[model samples]
Target: MTEASREVGVVLRRRPVDNPWIDHLWSPAMILDEVPATAPWTVLSTQADATIYYAGPASIELFSSDTANYRDNLADGEPRIWVALRRQDGGSELELTKVTVDPTEGEAMFESGCDVIGTVPMPPEIAAWIAAFVDEFHVERVFHKRKRDRAPGDRRGIPDEGKRRT
Candidate 1:
C-alpha cells in the first residue's frame, strides 16, 4: 500500500441520546469501555474541537474481526461508523472508512463512500495525539439508523401540464 493509502485502526463509540433519530442509529452497549472522564488533556489533544454527533469519545482504535461483532448484529439501514482524518496540512481530508462491525480477514464487507461529516481541518500532531489515546476492545450490539421522514407537503409549486388551473 502506498503511504497515503496506508491503514490505521480506530474505534467509534456511539454517543448517548434522547433523540429518536440519533438513538435509532446506534447502540451504546457496543462500547468497549467507558473512558475515564478525568483525562481531559489527553482527550482534548487527540480529539481537539472536532465536531462529533455522538455524546461520547467519538473515534477510537480498530482491533480484531471480533472486536466490533456487536455492529454485525445491528439491523440493516442504521448509520454505519465513519472516521475522518485531517491531512498533514490544513485541509480537512478524510483518510479512512469502515463499518463499526468486524469483518473476517481478507473479506471486503465494509464499503465507505466519500462523504465528509465535518469541514474543519485537523493538524497531524492533533490527529496523532488523539490516535494514541484510544483503547481497543471486543464487543457487539445491534445499532440503528434513523429512517428519513417526508416533509409536510409537496415542495413543487408548479402543477403538472394537465393539472394547470387555467
Candidate 2:
C-alpha cells in the first residue's frame, strides 16, 4: 500500500524530578512542523527546573488504511500527535522513535517499553495536511451483522459414540 510521510522536528524536555529513584524526567514537549536547521539533540533552552532539546527530525507516516482512525482523531476538539522516545543502549539517554497521527497506533505506543511517550497538540498545518490526505484516500467501511447458528453444535463437530448423525 502507498503511504504518505511528512518530515517534522521533535522537541523534548528534561526536567529535574523530586523522585528518589530517578534523577530526571524526560518527555516530548512539542513538534515543529518544519525541521529546524539546528543539529539533533541540541539544547534549545535551559531553565532552573527543565531543559528543552531538539530531539531531531522524525517522520509522521500516513497510510490510507488508517485514515479512519485519523479522521476520528481530528473530530476530537483537541487533536494530538503522539511521540515515542526510547532509551538508547549506550549512545544517548533517549532517542526519538516514532511520531504518529493515528490515535489507535498512538495508544498502542503506551504498551511499548519505551522510556517516554506523549501527545502534543496537533499543529494547524499538520492537521490540515492529514485532513487533506484523509479526504483523498479514506474509504468508508460498512459493518454487517452475521447470522448465528440455529442451535449449539458438538465441539469440533465430532460424532458421539452413543448418538451419531447419519
Candidate 3:
C-alpha cells in the first residue's frame, strides 16, 4: 500500500419494505463511510445520504479462486467492478462483502444474500487505480485442466496363476 492509498469503507443501509406481493424484501443502499482524501477525486453526485464520488489513485484486490466464473471477465477483456454489500443476522455492521469484476461470481454473491450495491464503471481514474494494484499484485494464474481417466479395460481381476477354475 502506498502513502496515497487509503481504504475507503463502503457502508450499506438496509430498510424494510412491506409489499403485498413480496413476503420479505429489504431495500439496500450504499454510501462511503468516509470520502477519500486525495487528488483528482471529487464528489460527483449525491442521493439522499449516499454519495457517489470520483475515486483517485488507489489500490484494490480481487478474490482469488480457480473457478472460471471468477476469471472470465479478466480473461475476456477489461473487467467491470462490482461492489457487494452484506449484513449478517440483521446486524449493524455493514460488510463490504466482495469486490469482483466477474459478473457470474457477483451474481452468485447477490443470490447468496450479498446485495450488489453498485457496479462502478471503469473510468480512466478508476481504471488507473485498479491497474496500479493489478500491475503490482495480480499474477497470471494457470488453471488446472482435468484429464479424463481411462475406463477399466477388464472387469475381472487377473486369475491366480495356480488357482483352479470353478
Candidate 4:
C-alpha cells in the first residue's frame, strides 16, 4: 500500500516487571499497519500488545459498542488493545484481513510471523493518513437505551396447620 493510503500507529508495551526502578511503564515498539488512529488513546496495560498514537486534534467518530465482547474481555481479566487491519491491491476495495489482538480474527497474519522493527513516535504524515481513514470510515452510532421491566408484586401469607392429618 502507498504511504498516503496506509493507516498507521504505534504499538506499545510496558517494560516487564523484572526491574526495580522502571522510569516509564509503557514504550512504543512497533508500527501498526491497519488500525486507524482516531481518538487520543490512553496508555493502557494490554496483556497482549497495546497501541498509542496522536489522533490529530479532531473530533473522533465511534461505532456501537460490542457489549458482549467487552464484558467477556473484562471477565477474562486480560486487557488487550484491538487492532484491525485492511489490505487493498491496486484499485480494489480495502479488505479487512487481520486483527492482532484477536487470535481467531488474525490467524493468517499471525502465522506469517511478522517482527517488530523498533519503537518510534507516531509520524505526522502517518498520523494524517490514519486521520483520513478514520474520517472516511468511522461512523457515529446512537446509543440505544434499554427499558427495565417491573416485577410482579405478590403479598400473600399461608396459615400454619395446628395438627398433622393422618
Assess each prediction's global lDDT (C-alpha) against the native.
0.32, 0.91, 0.48, 0.37
TM-score of each model, paired residue for residue: 0.19, 0.87, 0.43, 0.27
> Residues 1-166, candidate 2, lDDT per residue (tens digit)?
6599999999989999888888898888999999999999999999998999999999999999999999999999899999998888954578888999999999999998877999999999999999999999999999999965655663555566688567
What would the per-residue lDDT of candidate 3 be over residues 45-78, giving only the tens digit for each residue?
5565455434333233444332344345554465
Which candidate leads in TM-score? 2
Candidate 2 to truth, TM: 0.87
Ranking by lDDT: 2, 3, 4, 1
Give the per-residue lDDT of model 1 (tens digit) for 1-166: 1111122223322344568544422212222233444322222222332322222344333443343332342322342333332233444322333323323321332233333222122334433333332223333447899866667875565466666575
Top-scoring candidate (lDDT): 2
Inter-residue clash pairs, candidate 3: none
Give the residue spans of candidate 2 off by over 4 A: 90-92, 148-166
Reference-based lDDT, residue 64, model 4: 25
Which of candidates 1 and 3 reaches a greater TM-score?
Answer: 3
- Candidate 4: what lDDT? 0.37
Q: Give per-residue CA lDDT, model 4, range 1-166, as digits (tens).
A: 1212234454445444556664334434445444554544444344543334332222212222323332333344443333332334533222222322222332444445432112233344444544454455445558899965555653234345585656
